[model samples]
Target: MIKGIYETHIQVSNLEDAIQFYTQVLGLTIGQLDEARRIAFLYMPGGNKTSMLGLWEQTHDLQTRHFAFHCDKDFILHGATEFLQQNNRHPYNFLNDRSSQPMVFCWMPALAIYFDDPDGNQLEFLALLGGESRADLGVLSYADWLRHTTTA
Candidate 1:
């Protein structure tokens, strides 16, 4: 049985640029590179070899993908937006409301913020919240999630 994701691959327009972005910008460590095949594998920080990301270069008819990275609750709530902004990334929410704020998915009771990679691939930083599930609330700002959880 599958316990968790071990690896995932995405098509990138340029392998080198993608590697640099994931390494220098996102702080992933390079695991291996295949120059002939124009592919690279990267290891997530503190992943301890459990997680890997593959980037394959493809210039024609490329398809983008989405993925989420697990983050600490404090970082997600306090610093994720600012970190993204400082790195010139635009943070968005599931609602696409144009505000750069993390939103809470009441069903999962998880907070998350979304942004796009250079290839327009959607990526998310997410952290689970401690609270009773409130699926009826759908998705809302973190502040609202806090208020409702505390009062209810």
Candidate 2:
């Protein structure tokens, strides 16, 4: 079996804002400040803590766009609660086909939520359901999507 993800790096529009959201809002531990490299890595929950995220200060427009977090439902609500209480702002807002509530959304077998950083980059948190895991989840082929929509 695979050990875990080494890390996930994301370029941020503003490093300061990203830092605030992660450290203050989400309560993630911070690492060494490498201002010269314009990069910072954030860790996740687990034994080995192999899952980590990296934020890079963006000097230009972001190239790769989407980023996500896999967390528990209670953990997400707790984190989102703290985020709103701290910043007076909700993270997840439905860009399209979204509801008008904060920290609440549905997607497949995963309960998903979303929000943005100061630079307007989209962020997501997905709470996997019981007996469900991302291991079985993966890129969908066009044929699969077509079959899924059929009224059989």
Candidate 3:
């Protein structure tokens, strides 16, 4: 019955910093702001104000959270990675592996690149490459995934 994710809320240290990171780095659009409550809503691509990520101000002991934006195109993932790197953001692979580039989760056959926000929130841009259900294949490096997909 659930069709798609509409929204998610996460706490941030400062709303302004969060806004800068999300808007400038991640390229998400702002929807609404509750300055009194110290909260802001960031709308994702194709959101049209429907899909949102709420950022509530929280300073004390903020634990890093993970969230991903589903990229509609493979180039968007790679382009985002480049854009982030140019902005002094370091993209990470599984296990915080910066040495390796963005990887492919063979389980979903999706390409993913991960990075952190100003408040250390782990964020990702994921692009689904195919509609193959093969979780048993596990995660693969970008090159490996490409080779396997091409061969199979």
For each candidate in turn, the TM-score is 0.95, 0.65, 0.88
Residue 134, candidate 3: alpha-carbon lDDT: 58
lDDT, candidate 3, 74-150, per-residue tens:
56445766777787878888757555377778787788878788788888878888767557778777788767777
Q: Regarding TM-score, does 1 or 3 come out ahead? A: 1
Error of 2 at 135 (Å): 15
Question: lDDT by residue for model 2 over 1-152, one digit each (tens)?
Answer: 98756777778877877888887766666765688887888776444556777889987977556677777677654565465546755554444334423322222445555666666666777665443223343423223423433532
| Candidate 3 residue-wise lDDT at 81 | 67
Which one wins on TM-score? 1
Name the candidate, 1 or 2, with the larger TM-score value: 1
Assess candidate 2 and give its TM-score to the true structure. 0.65
In model 2, the clashing pairs are 91-115, 92-114
